[model samples]
Target: MNSPDSQWSFTAPLSAVPEAVNACLDQYFADSSKEFGSIGSEFGQAISYLKDFILLGGKRVRPMFAWAGIRAGLEGGGGSLSVPFPDATPNPKALLSAISALEFIQACALVHDDIIDKSDTRRGNPTTHRKFEEEHRQKGWLGSPEHYGISQAILTGDLALAWADDMLLDSGLGHKALHKLRAPWRAMRTEVIAGQILDVTLENTGSESVDDSLKVIEYKTASYTVARPLHIGAAMVGADPQVVDMLRRIGHDIGLVFQLRDDQLGVFGDPVVTGKPSGDDLRTGKRTALINLALHKGTESQVKKLRDALGVVHEEPEINDLRELIIATGAEETVEDYIRIHSQRAIDTLTAAGLSDAITSELVALTTKLNDRKF
Candidate 1:
């Protein structure tokens, strides 16, 4: 029963999701400041920074996914924007709370990831840690600026995580429903952190075999980014156990394709479109899908050149050469083939599981859009 209006509207949901997310975010800030008002002069400012980061401009895919999951659980009973899922009788306040929790968790992961990658900026702005360090410099703080920034970010991420846990517990979901929601969040945090660790360990270290790199993709990129978000959405609304399991399977296939597409974008996407430097991944020697493919299939001489060019941690023409090698080796086409295969798998899984017509159609369209995304 997958339909275009319902499933494809994942994009349309964003128009409303941020507003919902903000309603919850506002509540969180107000509560935190009230509780910790007397702690320090900087507490208010610190909390503001946290809020700002959550509101950072980018796709609020996670929160939307959560909302969709909740709605899907309700199973299509609602009649209007204000009360979309009439059958589920979902509490508006509870829905906002649950979505906001996912947003905070995402913020935590991004804050830490930016620091680990030494990324100066994110979402077209200075990272939280970097922004904090600049403030310290202006204030003439005594310690390492980057270190101070990282420390503050770590604490900020911790606070967001704690807030997420509290929000989930307070979501007004029944005890059993709350438990179901919490499980995925816990697993996602663990996997993302482990992935971050692996990502950091590889920096300036060396390239890993395809199998090892794929494992990192499974943990670091695919599962938490897409699969878990979809699961969280489903779990929130009390989707059936079997349906939830099926969602996990479908989500994983599409999620990996999503990341593989992203890896391609890192090198080939337009800077204006991607909102980042061109060939950024190559500059960082990121062991992306393209690189892994080239490694597995490139000629011996090509491999030698790649080893020299990759992970060099600098800007150079060599990156262009590396990009060419990726193309020359037909890795790009191979990667595209993989996208097609995985995306079809997602469609097959959803159809086989007999999702609602609206959801099934929407998921397929969304998968197609994701797999074909340029930015």
Candidate 2:
């Protein structure tokens, strides 16, 4: 097992990972576009929209973390760098293609999430369904615009998911590497789906506590966003079992930290910055940990203010009121403390895992950037 390396710190450049991932995604999208165009121009037009949606904006968090996982696996695999340092790692382009699948997974999750949330905008633009709805209206289509939008968006998300599988299988990593990746990939898909179901169930039934909220993210965000991606990377190279186990724990902690930050962003982040309307969570009646905390601790009137607005208020002023109530109850600060505690736990665990300075530094750096989401 690796031991803590004090020299490690996050110094990796951000540009390289996203750029590589984007280039690979472009190829995959082009390949897909060609296939769709061969079928029909209507199909071609829709795919073009999907392509723009994907390439528009994103942090590419999952693929970067997956890369970190790959590094971790490489260090422990056997070669001076890993078990299959030179061989199992495969060509650099192939590795990027494989991990880039995570971005598609993210796209599918978001497209579906927006549908479920009935969100009007994403990344400050109309959501998939809304975009399709506008196109339907523009072209004077024959059916209900709303239904057409929903159906098309669903298909778009499905295409993204199908292509995610294709990208991984076609990545040229060879049978052994692909076989290793399958387990985590399967698990991540299930966990995210289960998490989404749990989130919807809890919201409709009323999630009232921090534990309930945590349970939601544990499956919904943690595994899909962090833990399993790490597993996929480690598994990609057949990383040592002990190293894999350590990363799972670290990923879980980090995933929670990431989701907690998301909770804040959901309620407080600027639409310009977050790319979605502030208080979308509130409008959707989604009870995140921060909201749950406020519900438990806020004054009667403040609590009432939140309750009255839950799932009803769509415009301003009221949303602002709800935001203030959360702050006034001190839940925002309390959640920040929770974030500090969880983030520290993740870092400490990673430090104690004692992986190579290279892997340790990159993971720490990624975690830091994830945690420090001021916007």
Candidate 3:
């Protein structure tokens, strides 16, 4: 085991990748704006909203994962960064394009996610629908301002997603690499839509068992967040079966940890850190870890309270009370412990795969940073 500063340390050095990716995002949106028309201000505004989402600071974990997979495949046998490419040729430009594609795809997903969840903000900024809604009201838009905002934002997100696919296809990856990437990329998109439907269904109908909700979380949050990205990236570089299998297992462990951390943050992170109101999850009555815990472990009376809180999304003292109750019931601690364990497990899995220290170090660092995220 390598004694290191922390899991997040390696990530600090990787920040430049995200900045470059953001520059690409800016260009992408600018092109979209110009395509719509010089004077299509509404379209321009929507494109700007997409740019804001792309520029919003995040861990950039998915893009980094994609790059790492490409690197691993290019190096062959999945080892340290010290390992040179087979031909001793580094394709930095191609790698950067692929990474940007991953980030843009994530942006598209998040935009759609906010609309589905009716979230008001993201990364400390107004969500697309929320921004459009406010703009509509301020400008005294024609009939049904709220509906118009939602409709336009949804369409904008769809366009972003379509563009993401185009970026990936046009990323200049070789034919073999592109073919490898095709299946998982296509599957991920299809599954995400299916997952979204399941999510909406659960929110409306409610789950009788925690396991059911967990299934939804796995699909809606996990596969896209970790599994598919890993597979796609690995495929891009023509990873062999052994390496692909290892990446899948690692991706599952890391992805679940990522979602678990998000659940915890939804309940406990600072408003400034999370870019949402305190107890926002509770207000939205999101079926998160906290609610799942209450449903599973609370007394009957507490269960009733949790049910009542579902989908409220309003300002109320009871929302805060529910947050406290969730913590008091030990759900928060349970989730925290779960995150710590799986995060370490991910690192251990990577280490045992006999990867070089440099690669293992970076992978461990990525897992740690995500697990420890404040936002």
The lDDT leader among the candidates is 2
Candidate 2 lDDT, tens digit per residue, 1-375?
111122222233333677767777887887777766678877776677677778887888888778777777766533122322345643556667788888888888899988998888877778899988998999998989999999989998998888889888888677777777788999999899899998888878876978999998899988888899888877877788888888888888899989999999989988777867677788876789989999999989888888888889988888888888899999999988977887888888887876777677767877887888855
Question: What's the true lDDT of residue 211 in model 2?
Answer: 91
Q: What clash count does candidate 2 reach?
A: 8
Off by over 4 Å in 1: 1-15, 76-89, 202-205, 313-317
In what order do the candidates fall by lDDT, top score first? 2, 1, 3
Candidate 1 lDDT tens digits, 144-251: 998999999989888888887777777665665666667898888899889878866765476557776777888886788777877877776667777777777877
lDDT of 2: 0.80
lDDT of each: 0.74, 0.80, 0.71
**How well does each candidate superpose onto the true structure, as a TM-score?**
0.87, 0.91, 0.87
10 residues in a row with least lDDT, candidate 1: 1-10
Clashes of each: 12, 8, 1
